[model samples]
Target: MSGAAFETIASLVRTRAGIVLGADKAYMLDTRLGGLMRELSLASLDALAAKLRAPGSERLAAAVTEALTTNESFFFRDGKPFEHLKRVLPRIAAARGPAQKLRIFSAACSTGQEAYSIAMVAEQLGLLPRLEVLGTDLSQEVVRRAREGVYSQFEVQRGLPVQMLVKHFKQEAGQWRVSPALRAGVRFETGNLLADLRHLGNFDVIFCRNVLIYFDAPTKSRVLSALADRLAPDGVLYLGGAETVLGLTERFTIIEGERGVYAPVVRMAAAG
Candidate 1:
């Protein structure tokens, strides 16, 4: 690929998809695109990259975006957040009254584990009855898999407790699939965090974990701002352990409990 073409595509990808591809990631991109290149009948990553750069292959850009997107997820990833959820579920339940309803958005939920982990926690905490779970991603392929609610044994093995695994997922033809009752509570869709999220409605909590680390500062700010908008007034926002609300937006106040989680300000006046 031409240097200009690589730079142009990288810029467009970073701006539109919030993906920061540095020079060191050239090897990573080649590795990730190998399958795509083979399927596209291209001889080289450079050629494949150039083909995706061609005009009228706009959908190809979406495919490339999907290729570059990382989707490593598992049940209750990093334990602490779910532990916090367990602690707060009852309090949030009381705040919610009869509705006792909860909305959770697992941004960039790969396959289904992270979102399902929330479902398991909700069920275990007795919040399953009226829960609404939305797991969104930029890739259609992963979204479809999340909707299926199926997982490989290796996927299930990581981060899942033995008893919960036995309770929540059932083996069907060798693959472990989340049960109907549990699966019904969750929905998956393709979405762009950089775009308007008004259609996603309000959510009591948003788990946008592990994703922001891949973006630059401006993209991070833009994503955090959009997430803030989709978040309900009293809702909480959760980021990956490595991520924080620091310097992103002033809309949220960090909740100082169990290693620093964030709660969105119900009132702008209070936030300031």
Candidate 2:
């Protein structure tokens, strides 16, 4: 692909999905979009870029965006976050009155493992009766797979404890399918973090981990602010270990003794 075509494709992805593609990512663009070209019957990357440049090419634009978006995820990814959650679930549950539902959002939930992991934790804690887990991602394909609750043996093996796997999943045709009880009360949706998120409602916990590294400063701040708005008064926000709100926004303050856990600054102030 020519420099101009690469720039155009990068710009389209950044504008549409808030994912930054630096000059070094040209190879990634070529490799990912190369498949799209074959699927669309386009002869070259330049031809695919031309389709993207055409007016009323929303379909092509979406295809490019989906093709470029990273969907890397695994069950119980990063032990610390899940460990913190296990420790804190009781506190979150205790804060609410009896029979009140607790909502958890797994933002950028690639293929639904993180959300289901949360469900598994809740189930182990005997909190599933009052818990609701929602997993959202930029890719509709992943969200659909998440809803299906099927995983290859390899996918189930990653970060999924053997005991939990045995209890929460059943082997079916060489793939592990989430148990009906474990699948209960968990939902998945396709959404963009950079867009309006008011419809997602407030959450007791928001797991927006490992996704902010893709955005530039302005977009990162915008997304963090939006997440702050969606957090309930005492809600906790879990960011990637490398991501932080310290320099991004004052709406959240890192929880003491927690690696990726945060609470609304106002809530911290009130408690103080």
Candidate 3:
């Protein structure tokens, strides 16, 4: 691909998704976009770029953005976060009044594993009756798959415990399908984190893990601030190990002893 073609595609992706593709990722563009090329019957990457530049190319632009967005995820990824959740559920439950629901948001939740894992854990702990797990991703394809609650044998094996698997999944035609009871109250929707999130409502726990690393500093700060605004008082946020709110925004502070967990900062009142 010519330099001009590369830049045009990269610019469209960044504008549409807030994902910055550096010069080193030129090869990634070629590999990821190959399928789109074939789907569009384009002769080369340059042809695809030309199509993207044409008028009324919103659909093509969306295809390119989806192609570039990474969707890698597994059940209960990075065990520590789930472990912490198991320990803290009682406290979150206690804070809620009778019949009140606890909300958990799995932001950028690719293919729904993380959200389903949380639902499984809550069910195991007897908290599923009062919990709602919302899994959102930018890709419509992944969101639809997540809502289906079907997983391949390989997908089921990753980070999903054997006992839980036996208890929560039913094997059908070689794929593991999440039990209907386990699927209750767990919803999946297509959403962009960089867009307005107020309609999603406040959450007691928000898992925006591993997604912020793709954004530039300004976008990161803006996204974090928006998350903070959506967090209920006493709510907690979990970020990826490599990501943090430090120097990005002052709206949150680390929860001591909890790796990757953060709480909204509380400012003390002035002395009388």
Candidate 4:
């Protein structure tokens, strides 16, 4: 890919999905966009860029953006976040009245593992009936798969415990299908972190793990602020091990004794 071609695609991705691509990642264009190029009958990266520049190419641009979005995910990834979730859920439940429903949001949830893992935790705690787990990703294809609630054997084996697997999944034609009980507790949608998300409503907990590493500082700040807006006052936000809020935004403060856990900053009213 030429420098201009790379810049064109990178600009589109950054604008639409808040992902930053450096010149070193130019090779990814050829590697990741092969299927998209073939599907669109595009001859080269330069040609794709030209199409993206055309006035009627909004759909092509969206396709390219989706093609480049990362969808890597696995069940109970890194263990600690879900463990913290186990402790936090009951506390939140204790605070709520009998008729209230608890809500969780898994931003950039990839293929639904994180959301389903949350469902499993709620089920284990006997809170599934009163819980709602929403998984959102920028890629439409992954959202479809997440809604389908099916996974290959290799996908289920990664970071998923044996007992939980047996309890929540059943084998079908060499793949595992998530139980209807779990599926009923969760929903999936296509969304972009940079876009306005107020329609999703406030979440008691938000898992935006492993997503901010791809964004620049400004974009990171924007996303963190947006998350803070949608989080309940006492809600917790979980980030990736490498991602943090330091030097990003002041809308959140770290939860003491919890790694990668944050709570919204409480602003006091002025004295009369």
Per-residue lDDT over 80-162 for candidate 1, one digit per residue giving the tens place of the 0 to 100 score: 99998888767777788776568889888888788888889889887788788998888899989999888888888998999
lDDT tens digits, residue span 1-272, model 4:
67888889999998888889988888888989999899889899999998898899888988998889988999999999999999999999888887798999999998999999999999999999998999999999999999999999999999999999999999999999999999989999998888999999989999999999999999999999999999988889999988899999999999998889999997787899
**TM-score ranking from best candidate downward:** 4, 3, 2, 1
Best by TM-score: 4
RMSD of each: 2.3, 2.3, 1.7, 1.1
Model 2 C-alpha lDDT per residue in residues 98-159, reported as the tens digit of each score: 78899999999989999999998998889998889989988988999999999999999999
Highest lDDT against the true fold, candidate:
4
TM-score of 1: 0.93
Question: For model 3, how does the per-residue alpha-carbon lDDT over 1-272 read when each residue is reduced to its tens digit?
Answer: 99889989999978888988899989998789999898878989899888888899999998889989999999999999998899887789898995999899999988999998999889878899888989898899999999999999999999998998999999999998998886896999899998999999999999999999999889999999999988887888999989999899999999998788999876577899
Q: 2 or 3: which has the higher TM-score?
A: 3
Candidate 3 lDDT for residue 243: 92
Q: What TM-score against the true fold does each predicted structure earn?
A: 0.93, 0.96, 0.96, 0.97
Backbone collisions counted per model:
0, 0, 0, 0
Using lDDT as the yardstick, the better of models 3 and 4 is 4
Which segments of candidate 3 are over 4 A away from where they belong? 267-272
lDDT of 2: 0.89
